[model samples]
Structure formats: C-alpha cells, structure tokens
Target: MSMSFGKSLAGSVLALAAASAAQADVPQVATDIAPVHGLVARVMDGLGEPALVVQPGASPHSYSMRPSEARALEQSDAVFWIGAELEPWLEESIDTLASDALVVELLGVDGITTLEFREGATFEAHDHEHGDEPHADHDHDHASEEHAAHDHADETAHDDHDHADEASHEGEKHDGHDHGDEEHDHEGEDHAGHDHAGHSHEGVDPHAWLDPENAKTWLDVIAEDLAELDPENAETYRANATAGREEIDAAMADVETMLSTADDVSFVVFHDAYHYFENRFGISAAGAISLSDATDPSPARVEEVRDTIRDLGVACVFAEPQFNQDLVATVSDGTDVQAAVIDPLGFELEMGPDFYPELIRSIGDSIASCTSSS
Candidate 1:
C-alpha cells in the first residue's frame, strides 16, 4: 500500500509540471472591442484566445466597465485598445487597473492611415452608373461664427426665422451650464484620464478596422507584439497574421464587387462610425444622426439630419443594432427613403477569426440591398 501511494504521488507531480511548462509560453491577452478581439483571436488562433472587454451588443462609445471586466483587465498580461479617441472611457479604467500590462494603442501604430472627422463631410452624390457629379460643396465653414450664422440663415430660411438662433443659444447653454450632473461627472471623472488636448472628439476618426489595409497593418503589429512577449510562438503568430492579412484582402475585394452592383445609394447611420468603411469602399453615406453615442442628438440636430435626407435625395437610412431604430424610422417616416439596419460593431454577429470580414461585408450587403432596389 505504501509503495502504490508513492507511485501515485510521483505521477501527479509529473502531470502538474507538464501543465505548468505548457502554459508558461502562453500570455493572457485582452482586447477592448469585439472587432478588435476578432483580429487578435485570428492572430492567436493556435496560440490562445484573448479576453474581450467590450462585449457584443455594447457600444464602445458609451460602455461602462463592469466589475468583472475590470477584474479581467487587472489580471490580463496584455491589453489592446484602439486609442483614447476611440474609447475615452476605457483610458482611465485601463490606466488604473492594468498599469503593469503591455498596453497597445492600435490607432497610433505606424502605417495605419487615420482620417479626420471633417467639419462638414458628406457622401458624394453618385448616379446608378457610378458617375460622380459634384455633390454639395462644403464651403460653409463652421469654425467661423459669422459663416456659421450665415449658413444657418441660408439653410433654414423657410421656417421660423429665429428658430436657428434660438436653438443655437440653447445648445450653447446646454454645453456650458446645463449638461447635468451625470454629464459633468463623466467629463470630470479622474482615474488616470486621457489628455484630451490633441485627441479631442473633433480630431481623429477611430474606425480604422473598417479598412482592410489598416487591418493588415494592425495584424502585423499584433503579431510583432505577441512575438516580443512569447518568442516560442513567434513563427506561429507571424504565419497566422500573414494568413489573416490575405483573408482580409480577399474580403476587401469581395466588398468592392458587392458594393459596385448598387448605385444612387446614400444612407445615414445612427452615428458617424462608418466613415472608415465608407471611405475604403467608395460607398458614401449622406450623414449621421449623431456624432457619438454617449449623448443623444438634440431635436434640432435630428431635424437637420432629416433635412439632409431630403436635400441629398438619400435612398436609405440605416440605424445600428446597438441603438434605437425608432429614430431612423422617424427620419424616414414621410419621405420615400427606406429605413434599414447596418451594424459596424458586429454586435449580433458571431465573433471569431471571420468576424472582421463578416462585419465589413455585411455593411456592403446592407448598403447594396437598399441601394440596388431603390
């Protein structure tokens, strides 16, 4: 009996040693968004899966970190996020919780092309044949108060003459003094918050993954970072990243072919999150209902978007799965425009190696569906 017990203990010790050795090379990684996790998962296909911070069906723009998510960040070996511009809320939380982890800001990665949120960027008006006539000229500069007033007058000449001015004052007041305690707390909350000077909302467009070229760039970065962390799996990571790049390139071609079949299509999304996708595929949207999801668009802003749909002869208005569709329906109610759903976040899609391509391709399909029929 004593000999048998000694042999069993030796066997258990050997198994534990083997398990620890196997896991020694693996790093516990985490990502900020589902689409980003999809990319990282593809890169670490054979290696391991990374934790996702922003779960499916949640908007990264307005996500509040759950305690579980916070604990996950605390325990992660590496945390990858786009940047402070894409997720200002995560900036402070990450800094506070994961100060020791290898934090990567993908938007700041070299070779990734970042576009600015134009003061007044709109989709180019194209006919069914894809012939691009000059769309509305963006000559009205919003930065200059005089030009703003003049353009507001010119655009709203029909309705109550003082409506625009009154609304402008109301908006200014809301921004300055009437934002309420919740909004004020969000703005002033301190947990190693972001330096908003350069990365303000008006500066960078954070939808880089929508472009396949940028995905390829980010994949290379991911592989490189993982390689630095786990040299044993360096070759495997590089191979997976290369394969992922090829897959993304193929998906980009597929999107181009799919989107080309449709013409005379213009859309307005829930928010301005699809510009990277739009600019990549030459597919244009008329405008967005709001700038960000954190705050609701004012009534005047919604009315302005309604006017855009009418003036641009927009064919379809697309809302996001993560937001209320009633707003889209309201915008299209009396018009000939069709209301549809386009999800940029892959909120409803199964997330994995194929998620990035599916997200991009689905947007194309959604646009084609509405535009081709219209």
Candidate 2:
C-alpha cells in the first residue's frame, strides 16, 4: 500500500477537509420558542443554520413534541429556553432527552424584578388589561421614574435588563412600583421592575423580543452561551452577534425616529404584545386586547377599549396576522382607530435566518407607517 509523497499529502488534506466539515456540522439546537430560534439564528449567522425543531403556528406553551423533533432534541448540543414557567409543556422532556444535551433556562440568568401574578393569573393577559390597569391619556413622566426605580432596584444585580426581558416586561411589574415611588402622573408610564424570582406573571406581555432593547439583552446571553458550548468557535459567534446586533440597534434607531414624529401615534392592538415597542419608543397606544399570547377580547372588554380609543383619539386599531382581524374590526367599528395588523410572532416577515431582528424591524416599519400616516 505504498503511495507517492504528493499523493499522500493530497489524500491527507482531503481527509482533513472532510473531517472539518463533519465536525462543523451545526448543532441541532431545539428551541422552546420562536424567539429562541431568532437567538439561534443570530448565533449561527456566520456559522451554518441549526435545525428549527419547533416551528411557528405551533404553540410552545402547549406544544406536543413529534418523534422526530424529540430525536432532534436528544441529539442537540443545547436546548436554549426562557424557562419551564414560560413553556410548561417542554419541561417534562428537557431532562429525558440526553445527558450531554445542555438545557439552558435563561430566565434564571436574567436579573429582573418580577411581579408575581396577583392570583389565578393564567396564560391569559386578556383576562385583564396590561399591568394593573389600562392607561388613561395623561402626560406623566412615569417611564423616567420607573427606569430610575428599576435601576435603583437593580442597584445590585449583574444582569439588569436581561432579567427584565426574561420576565417578559409585563406592564404590571413595572407598574407595580411602590406607591411611595409613584411620582409619575403619566397614565401609562409606570411600567418598570423585573421579576428576578421567576415565580409567574402568568403570560403578561410575553413577547419580550418585541422591544429592541430586550432583544439585545437576550442576544448577550445567547452569544455567551454559544461561546461556552463551542469554545472553538467563540470568535465566530461573538463576531456574528456583534454584527447582527447592529441590525437591532438600527431598528431601535428606526423606531425612535418613527415614533418621534407620529402625530396620533396610538393604536388598539388585538394583543398587548406591542407594549415593549410602544413603551420603548414613546408611542401612545390603546388596546382592546390582553397580555396573553392567545386571548380574545370580550364584548364588554371590546367596548372598554373602543371607548378609550374614542376618548384618547387613537389613530389605528391593530391585529395579528394569525388572529381574527374581524374581531379587531368589530371592536373598533365606529371608532377613529383603523384596524391594522401587527405581528409579534415574526410569522409573516422575511427575516432571512434571524427572524427576531427582522420581526422587530417589521414591527417598527408597521408602527411608523401606520402612526405617521395617521
């Protein structure tokens, strides 16, 4: 089996190339939510894409794993999740999959001042309005005070905003600031605080990524986790995230610009997913919706929002691409708020691989176009 010198070197190079390709095969990281996929996509931006085991349209809160997805989970290098409380269904199998598979429940890692659900708080935020109460049109510097308090509270935590996003930025937790600290007279500006305990806010404003700032928080953790899981590719992951995060930064800039000039920058959303975006950009909005991801407004609830829209002079009524637009129309029938669609799910947008960033941009564009035009 003697070979020429050049032949032997060529053969060795070929073998090494093949081995590298096989080794670099992207990890089959299964996510508990679509937003996690966004994280994964950003992490894998320079690297290859991971297999998206769980998909859109499927409810992560109550999703049933298929045998194939189960197999993928078992084979995955890591399963990045917000936490079991956020996605209860995946808790059972998280440990059963594989011993080597790293299950990262990031909710624990994020440092937030969480406000536990009052009582009987289910996944339905629609069971109640965002936070303690829907805002009335009042010009209060509530947000500034809320941030001061949150920073004051986070006075000690390592991960300040990260914990807050893990808590989903429920309006109530921020609104739940102590009465003595309630200096802001603004109607809807009281949202602050993070639930570091991870007890539960039920499902109050679970679309943390909707806010560009929170998306950056999650990406920081995602980049760190990816580095830990694959130290060899640490540079690649960091570089990718740093570059990809610019998109989010740009999106934040865009949202800031859009909301700054919106004359009647307000809407009644089918869902309360936009609170983070609205609050972040200072866009005043009213909703005939609740905090839960899949809650429908009741007749009485619709009327309440309708009245608010009329009173607040809300410009647009928003709906999700997946939900019933008819409901939004029916509720906002005679009000000045025109029914428009906004997607927190990232379902309809062309996000390339990084769906979350694209989703944020899309949301910003929609908000800007709708509000400014209104």
Candidate 3:
C-alpha cells in the first residue's frame, strides 16, 4: 500500500519520539520548503536540523512529495508546512499521519493578519483555477473595513489584501480573514483538540509567511511546538525562536525601508510571490506574469500584463530563480520588462545553515537595488 502523507507524518513523530540523547544527529524535522525549513532550523537551534522537501529555486506552488521527501518526513520529529491551501498536496493524507509528529501550518499561526486568496487580489493564481473562495476571517474584516480608505494600500497597497475595498467595488466587499491555521489545539481545546489536526478556514493566502514578520510567527510557533514536543529542551527552542525573531524583526525593518520609497514604485515580475515583500515596503508593481506557483500565464494574461506594464511604465519584471525561465523570456523579453531573478526560497545563499534570515535580507536588498541602480 502506498504510504500517505499523514501516515508518513505519524511515522515521523514516532521516529522523533524515539530520538533520545543517544542519537548522534540533530532531532529530525521536515519542512515543505526552504523558507519553512530555514525557520524550523532556527527554532530547533541546532538541536536537530530540519530538512525541506522542496529545495531552493523550486516553486512551492506545484511542489509534490517525492519518495525521498516522504521518507524524510517519516523520520522527522515534526513536519512544518505553509498551510492546507498553499500546499494542498499534503491535505488529505496529512491527517493520517501519526499524532505524535507535530504538523505545523505556519500561515495559521496566531497574531498575524492574513489576507484573502481571491480573484484579482494581488498577483494571479497557480493552483486554484476552480474559483476564489472567501475565508471566514478575512471576509469579515474586509466587510468591517468596507469604508476603510486607501490607506491600507499605501505601502502594501497592491499586496495589502484588503479585498474589502475590492469588495465594495466588487459588488460586495469583505474583510478580516483569520484562518488561524496555526492555532494550537492545546489538547483540551474544542473538538478534543481536533482543530490541531488541520486548518479551520480556506482561501486565506498561505504565503503570508513570505513576509518576514509572518515568518517570525512561524519561528515562534516552531519553538512553541518544539517545546511541547521536547520539554527538556523547551528553553533551547524558546531561545532559538527569540533569536530568530530578533533577526526577522531587524530584517523586516530593512525590507520595509528598502521598499519604503522605491525608485520605481511600479515594477513587474514573472510570478506573484512578492506580495509580502511588496506589501512590507509599499511598492507597487504593474502586475505579475504568473498568477500562482502551479499555474502558468495564459495568452490573455500575457497580453493583459504586457499592456499593464506598458501603461505603468514598469522598468523591471522580476523572475524567480527556480521556475522555468522560458515563460519570462518568451513573454517579457524585448518588452520594457527587464527580467531579473528574485530568490523567494533563499535558495542559493549559504548564510550558515541559518539561511532564512539571510534569505529575506538578501531578497530585500535585491528589490532595493533593482530600480535604484538606474
């Protein structure tokens, strides 16, 4: 029988439970992608380094579990994923995983304001061609803030995800989406802590962690979960999360500053992964060539983006380091869209094994310099 993601996850928890001090290697953990892995590594604080199923320069949008990655998850103490919608591949099977292994959906981590995953929100879509649904939380806030001015759009305007604004003009606007995917089931919690089994809401964007602040939440949750899993090293997990958050806090400021006042407020890109990045600093791009990680741009999308770029006079159309370069070159080439590479995964940077911080900062610097060079 084929092992499911949940079964693999359960086996991972067991393996991790058995990882006593006698073990030579670090505690075992598995992440869905480089960013989450980097955050996990930070929270783990060298006690056990986590591995990512998705390597750097890879698109998390279309990523699937490979045998090697699945086996790795089986050996993990905990498995960290972005969220159900972000990584739908892990959804059904993740439940089957052993209860011992911790499954973290970072975007659902508390204390962060998540955005709506709706049509014409920020970039385009990759995985969801079916339709744009509303998260109960985001949808509420959007409606509450229905009268909110364009202030939300100031910095993260295009990426702020105040779909409520879009809602009004959209025949109906809504706000305050809180999928809270990371809410700890706290054992005694409702449904007998079954909420910890998975996510609560849907259509809330999972890439919120791509924002440095959101990533800090992931680190915090990782540390908290680690402490829960290994009370002996709870302090260690806390310390690591604290350090990681500090780094992230500082890095977020830098990203904010880098994006605060762009030389060219309007730019373009191949993919829409930079919503967090763009929102942090208030920079607005014309639009993205690619909508989601799993999907490609259609001919209509291409023309629409082309027209937008031309109208907006965007200088740069950033391309991701891991995706197929052909689309970017094919459509963006020769146009005013100067294609540049952006590393959302922190793919190539070897900032120690602690590359997550370095990854965000590096990307910040890249965006900062992109238009300013002119």
Candidate 4:
C-alpha cells in the first residue's frame, strides 16, 4: 500500500511539471509604444510579458532604439507597432533587426477607423449640435462655399469703399497686399513640406490608439497574432483579449459619463493628436497649436491659434509632456482659457493590462476638470 501511494504522488508531480512547461512556451512579443505594449501585455497576461521598444515619456516620433531594445526586437517572435506613420524612425530598424519576426502594423489592421490629418495649426470649430456624431461626418462643402462667397463679397466691398483714401495709399496698400500674399504662400508651402517630417503618411492620422474603440479592436488582433505564434496557449490569449475588450468598454462608458457635461466646452490641443479620442467621445478640439510635433508652429500659425482661442471662447488648452509646455502657456496667455496637461501615451501610468483603460480615463478626467471649472 505504501509503494502504490508513493507511485501515485510522483506521477502527479510529473504531470504538474509538464503543464507548467507547456504554459511557459509563450511567444516572445515586442511592442512599439507604452499603450501598444500594455494591450499586448493584456493578451499575454498569463503567458508572458512583451518587450517595450519605445519607453514611456520618450517621443516615438524621433526615437533611437537602444541596444537592449534592439536585442529584444532581434529575439522577438512577433512585433507590433502603429506603423511607419507614427514612428517613421523605426521602419529601418524593424526591417534590419526584426527580419524574422511576424510584424503587425496595428494602424493597417481592418475594422480600425482612421482619421485624416487636420491640415493647419488652427482648426475650424467643430459643430457638435449633432448628438454623438463626430465632426468628421459633417459635410464641409456648404461651409466652404459660404466662406468663398464671403471672401468674394469682402473683395467687392474693398474695391468699392476705399477710393477716397486709395489715391494716396494705393501704392502702399498694393505693395503690402502683394507682399502679404507672397508670405502667406511661402508659409503654406513650408507647412505642407513638413507634413511628412515626423509622420510620413499624408492622409491617415497615426494616433489611433487614443480611441478606446480602436484599442478594443486591437486587443483581438493582438490575441489572434499571439495565438498564431503560440497555438498551445491560444485559448488563454483569446480569453485575455476578450476580457481586455470588456474592460475597455467599461472604461469608455465611464469616460462618456465623465465628459457628459463637457459637450459645450471647447478646447485646443498642443497638436492634432487627439482627433481619434475627440471623435470617439463626440467632443472636439477647437484647434491645434501646431500641425505636427516634429515642426515648430510658424509665427503666423501661432497667431492663428491665438485668434481661434479668443474667437471661439475656447475654455482650455492642453499641453503634452512630450512637447514644450511653454507653447501651451503662450497660446493660453492673455485669455480666460485654462491650461492643463494631457498625456496620451500613458507615460506616467504603471505599464500593464490596466494602463490603456487608465490612460483613457485620465484623458477624460483631465478634459473634464478644465472644462468643469471654466
């Protein structure tokens, strides 16, 4: 009886060891940013932790991967990123270092909604009278026509009204108008030229992670990719992803509740990175201080943003930790606008499965706080 009992105990121990070994065979996953890393970490919760390429608080726009990060990419079985648009600097490194890894560009994933980049530093005020519908869905053709008609009327009025003083100031006014036109044209060209500086993609905004909907979609994508790489833990990966999606849904609901009072509040961002978040929540930024973070706002662009804030009665201006805080102060100075910091990258948040949802809530809280006081 004693010998038989000992045999059974040894058999049970061996079976437990085998189960542990099987569970340990997770794929080596690497992710680009903190948010992406957090999503991947959720899907890989019990399986393993994925390596983060770009550390939190570092700008993915102009990042140089360290040797350790490169080594992680080199050893990875799979790699995920937003794509070349957000981190153009990582493309070459991925091509060379992660040659064998299954590369998944989250931005190109299907079912994810991508928004176009707002053209200038200052954006046109978005009309939010349509409940829950994003400003992107609105037809701007009518507005464009009205603007053109107004410009034509202004030209006609100027031609007819100023003849009394025009004789004396004609040469001065004509020269000034021509010079102004030339300077405007030059600035436009300069802005257009830098559109591809940090983000190579012309039309698609790469900051899709700001939208909780997109993050939910990406959770499934990450699970499927990880499942393909490590079929042994496929069920665990998928279960984790489903749980993550549910968490995101809960977080989104909380954000909606938080921002319910902020519908009428208008604000501006340091740059046009929050459109996805704004669109998702049915809120909108009045304008951006700069078109892209890679380039500084031109003097004219700064003045335009100032005009937007004053004209629109914008209540708040958000600064990002990744960029200059002085710019936000400058834009909000001399106005009744309140200034606050919003970090989309989840830089200060503890990295893990909870990071994404917390990041979303933090953003909502930041916006609500400023708008509530104003």
The root-mean-square deviation over C-alpha atoms between each candidate and the true structure, in angstroms, is 12.8, 12.4, 16.2, 14.8
- Model 3, runs deviating above 4 Å: 1-27, 96-99, 118-202, 351-353
- Between candidates 1 and 4, which one is better according to lDDT? 4
Candidate 2: C-alpha lDDT: 0.55
- Ranking, lDDT, top scorer first: 4, 1, 3, 2
Candidate 3: residue 45 lDDT (0-100): 62
Runs with alpha carbons beyond 4 Å of true place in candidate 1: 1-20, 120-200, 292-294
lDDT of each: 0.67, 0.55, 0.58, 0.73
For model 3, residues 167-193, the per-residue Cα lDDT tens digits are 001111112222222121223222321
Model 4 has how many clashing residue pairs?
0
Highest TM-score against the true fold, candidate: 4
Best by lDDT: 4
TM-score of every model? 0.75, 0.69, 0.69, 0.78
- Model 4, 127-227: lDDT tens per residue? 33323232232222221232212111111122211111101111112211221121111233344324322333245678989988888878887787777
lDDT of 1 by residue, 78-192 (tens): 7788766666567767777887777777776655666655322243432223343222222222222221121111121222111111111112221123212223122332222
Residue 34, candidate 2: Cα error in Å is 3.0
**Model 4 residue 331 distance off true place after TM-score fit, in angstroms:** 1.4
Would you list the clashing residue pairs of candidate 1? none
